[model samples]
Target: MRVGRELTIGTLSRRSGVNIETIRYYERIGLLPAPPRSQGGHRLYSGEHLERLVFIRRGRELGFTLDEIRDLLGLMVGKHTCGEVQTMALAHLDDIRAKIADLRRMERMLAATIARCQGGGRSECPILDALAGG
Candidate 1:
């Protein structure tokens, strides 16, 4: 892509692999600075917009919330310390670990309950019994 090439929202969505509605939502939420428009009022996204969208998409893929991504983007715009970014990353890492632990616990319980289940013939389902107990 050219350095200054202007792209339509459709083209940007295709190029960045982000949905058009997502792009509009990002703009509305101020995650993305609104782009310039054509005389017809079509949003004309530039390379910068594409780059930012890709960045936002990657952040989302990595499980960052929009607010977290906003904080990271905040770092990109002004003078900042690597320490600040690292701190956020560390906190997010902790959150991921906790979620993984919870998921593992859930998996084990569900697997055990399913194992106890005799399957099709019996009306007494271990899964339902466990759910009822809770």
Candidate 2:
């Protein structure tokens, strides 16, 4: 559908790949504006809702927290400069890089533990010994 056209909540959920409850939660958190309700009290979402929901879902998949997504959405609405959005994205990138570094450290620790236990019996298992605080 075209932007600005009305759609049912189900349609929006399907199109956006976001759950119906999540859509409601976004509305409650002010990340998304509450759409107009139909005569039957059902939510009638418009194209703008679809666009915003897509943005939210994509941001979530990229590891952004709801608060970060909110800031990005605010920037979009306010027509802020691209530099501001880039700054937020760069911060998120740094966070992801740090997590990768932590995971690499964990991998090294696990590998060392495995190496220490290779061909060892249960009584000599350094992995379990380490876990047991030995």
Candidate 1 overall lDDT versus native: 0.93
> How do the residues 31-124 of candidate 1 rate in per-residue lDDT, one tens digit apiece?
9999999999999999999999999999999999999999999998879999999999999999999999999999999999999988988888
Tell me the tens digit of each residue's lDDT in model 2 across 1-134.
36667889899999999999999999998888998898889898989899899999999999999999989988987979999999999999999999999999999988988888867355577888878888
TM-score of 2: 0.87
Q: What is the TM-score of each candidate against the true structure?
A: 0.95, 0.87
Highest TM-score among the candidates is held by which one?
1
Clashing pairs in 1: none
**Residue ranges of candidate 1 with Cα displaced over 4 Å:** none
Q: Where's the lowest-lDDT run of ten residues in candidate 1?
A: 1-10
Residue 28 in candidate 1 has what lDDT? Answer: 99
